[model samples]
Target: MQGFLKVFGHPNPKNPIGYGIDSVFPQLIADAQCLHIVAGRGFACTILIATTSKGAIYFGRLLLGLSNGFLVTFSNIYVSEVAPAYLRGVLVALVSPWVSMGAILGAAIDNATKTRVDKSCYQLPTACLYIVPVLLSVGLFFVPESPRYLLFQRYEAKAKQSLVRVRGELSNQ
Candidate 1:
């Protein structure tokens, strides 16, 4: 399914809607975090409504997929660009392990709630999805944009500021 979606993931050469989305969003981290928050909320809502209807569950899955597509793509690019060269491979590799940890944590939460007779069973598990995005949104405020992005956009001063924030005093290097 993900492989099939990758086809659409590529920016259309003729329309370039995806390119515009990528370029126009000045704050990539914040925007990606926002996408996570919305996706989390959408998943929670979908699960809640899913108790009543099949259609709502399907719709929620669709929304979750869309938001996740954007979040993963943007976050990966942003992280790769922002990370220092020495740590770039380690940081990128960490993404998969973190995803695995999330899966484990989610399974633990589901296991704990599985015995409940009421709606709390699903609600509790679904609510756990909010934790990462909520924390990420707050953390992003402390993070600087990718220096490369700033440089590419021709904001040399801001790029330097971002580099200083990430690399800590370039010192004529």
Candidate 2:
């Protein structure tokens, strides 16, 4: 496994860096599962938006990157825990398609769909990268903040609200 992950942003033997980023993905996503998905999106979007701007995009992007990490880690586990027993499988199942769709979308947008006005292609799957996170975040708004998060946070009202919300949504014929 250790030998396998030496591929991400790996160092080019022909050029300078001693090693490469390698395929650290399995470890990368091991904890959060969605870490790669969200971070890739965040990173792509940050790169695109930052390139056009002049100053201090670095710190902002850094924060976004960190947020991407923390949020995805927190959320994936959060989702699994709060979901009802029967719905647990369904929730985890969602991770697969979302990750795939985001990657595909990023491929499409970054493929060459730059702004019509500028005619410049900033990145591959550019649209998809930016759009994926936004879409996921938006969908998140509809998702209940895990019962565990709320209960642990001691926001009783929210916990109850979450339960009622999911139940209502499910029971609606």
Candidate 3:
């Protein structure tokens, strides 16, 4: 298993500088995930406003694609790693429904704006995209780091504290 992980780069390649900024700031991955989402929404909003400029819209869309790819991959990883063991499956399963809800909301917005002849048609829907990422970015600040990540970094006390925070009091359990 260790050999397979090494071959596949499961833990990622070692940096000569000792993990660089990540070592100094443990929340780098989470911050990056939030950044990608916020930036993606920014691109979407920009694309909507650039109705006359096909090139600008196309470039914005390309950036959106890159941001969304990173956002989805990192979000899933973050959720799975951070969730408590007993609730892991439930938390992971909720991801699909959460995504579906966003689609449903977007569709409803599109339906409402379908009759508009002005730029408001796409602009309203695009503007709505900002809500989720903004809320998510703010929400991330309240959550603790993944216990596994803390443990891997040899921060046992912090890992235990994280588990306690996520799982709640031992007496309740």
**Candidate 1 similarity to native, TM-score:** 0.74
User: Which candidate tops TM-score?
Assistant: 3
Candidate ordering by TM-score (highest first): 3, 1, 2
Which clashing pairs does model 1 show?
Answer: none
Query: Against the unseen true structure, what C-alpha lDDT does each candidate score?
Result: 0.70, 0.57, 0.73
Cα lDDT of model 3 by residue, 29-92, tens digit: 5567677677676767677566668787787777767776767777788788877678778987
Clashes of 3: 0
- Winner by lDDT: 3
lDDT string, candidate 1, 70-124, tens digits: 6666778878887888998898788789878988998999999999998889878
User: Considering summed lDDT, which 10 consecutive residues are worst modelled in model 2?
Assistant: 22-31
The digit string of per-residue lDDT tens for model 2 on 1-173 reads 22432544454575243443422343244434444456655764666554755453565466556766666566667677877889988987787797687667666666556555462555343433465567665674466555554665446777677777765544544
